[model samples]
Target: MSLRRRILILVAVVCVLAGVAGLSFLRAADRAEQRGRTQAGGPEIARGGLSLTPGEDGPRIVFRNMAWGPNRDELASVPAAAPEGARTASGVSCLRFHSAGGTGICLQAVKGGVQDGYRAVVLDARLREVSAHRLAGIPTRARVSPGGLRVAWTVFVGGDSYAGTNFSTRTSVLDLGTGRLDASLEDFTILKDGKEFRNADVNFWGVTFVADERTFYATMATGGRTHLVRGNLAARSVTVLRENVECPSLSPDGKRLVFKKRVEGLPAEAPWRLHALDLTSGTETPLAEERSVDDQVVWRDDRTVVYSLPGDFGADLYAVPADGSGAPARLMASALAPAFLG
Candidate 1:
């Protein structure tokens, strides 16, 4: 072919490719706009004053609102007695959140040039920033101690892991009272089977604190096995309690723990089954929910527990008997990371 003919063909190819790229960009933008629109039959959400301060309202519940529209992903609240009622959005957004004793731990993205940057922000009762710490990765789990004196969070750092994914976690604990931070739980002493354990691939996540504030529980993974470990803040140590336990949430009375357990023969996409563990008797009772739940559950009461499951609008809250008796019931739609307050 002549040189002029070849040049014309190349220009035609470039134009075709440009058109295809433009069409894809428009489609993506349209999808993003659709997400901002309110979906029919979804929960009602409106902007309003939200406070973590307890005892004013008659038992309210705060959560990350997963509902569609302008308030989506913001910290929201509704009366605990009527979780299905209209939500009041706080306008503060977080990827993961939890609160107790009038304080909140918000794991949120840092909006700006750095797209992947995130931070763990300590918030006051009125949702004001008390302090912020730069995070090294994507935020996953967050918790504030029962006394509100401590906060903990976990972020996903990329890597191929024993759990069969390119995922790893950095769990950190911060003393709100003293402003002291343990940047990674991996820094603490690990006691496994009555001996100090150390490994390069160890990862920790899903922290739950007891009433004493210093005592807590978290999931530790190493060598392809996960264990529930009792953590001591003062001593900076963790003792492995049992194997195959992940995301353990202590009962309100602190006598039992509701956790996710990996069941054999299940698909890797959804491998966990909720189970209640009796601390005194060392008994594990599988809950009635047959579907896999991948959440760190919260105790609604000593007898009941609440957790999130995948839903049309991201996630929904569900409740089940802590004793593994009654069937699971949907508590609220389009909500995640609930914290009950009086």
Candidate 2:
């Protein structure tokens, strides 16, 4: 072959080889992104849908796929219970039952040998995993709307403690019906004293939604003070209802709110007491179980409240009367989060 012809042919071969290699690299990268790993080292993708029809059996307390009857000792594993054929991802930090039918779970998986962000997993009434979304911060709280059309969560990014300095939180809401996700409540406009309010140090967490999906309640902390505020999801705005409320859980009847109030004359290590506020009468009554409760209270029903407290073994669930009567009674021996399985 002529020298010039030989040089041209060699150059063409090199270019072709380079192009093929580049395409292969791009395809590999795309596959890795799709097959993300769960904290339990399983594929993060959802499986097929499963039947969510409740058994003829009565109501059950569901934690993950495990169901416990009235007798805590009679526990049965129902790993196949997820509706829509979805399974609970491993490394779930929190789980809440959706009133409409389904479950919302927050997974805190580890990536690159460090605590990665959280994943909000949605399961249908049949207990099938339906959708999953990546979220920012450490999962601190997770809640589903009364109708199961909405999911809300709170994550703590940086801070040693709730009352510690230099910590922040992100509260987000997702509309399953609309497939719209609000990653942060900080974007919502705040109305304090009937005027627009904005501040750099504002932080929000502990979101509780009412029966009406458009209206909700959350904790907003700013200027070293925590206030309970009622929010309108449609308007994207909040109106301060009261102050000194950390985490508020709305009553099923929508007539009262149960929350933790910082009690005076107590050591800073544990200074909160559970209290119920009557929304109409504006009366705050402390519950009879006086041990420092540092958890967002859950209303098991109109008259009973459930919460978690730390113990030597782990966090245990307890129940108390909402009307400031009866002592704290232990329900679950070592359950961190408790929600009624609807």
lDDT of each: 0.89, 0.69
Cα TM-score of candidate 1: 0.87
| Residue 90 miss distance in model 1 (angstroms) | 0.9
Worst lDDT 10-window in candidate 2: 69-78
* Root-mean-square deviation of Cα positions for candidate 1 versus the true structure, in angstroms: 7.7
Give the poorly placed runs of model 2, Cα more than 4 Å off.
Answer: 1-55, 64-100, 110-115
- Model 2 has an lDDT value of 0.69
lDDT of 1 by residue, 1-342 (tens): 999999999999999999999999989756744443346767666677898975466889999999877778999999988899878888899999998899999999887784759999999999999999999988888888888999999888886332464579999999988889999999999999889999998999989899998999999998888999999999999999989999889887889989999999998878889999999999999999999988889988889999998998999999999998989999999999999986
**Model 1: colliding residue pairs:** none
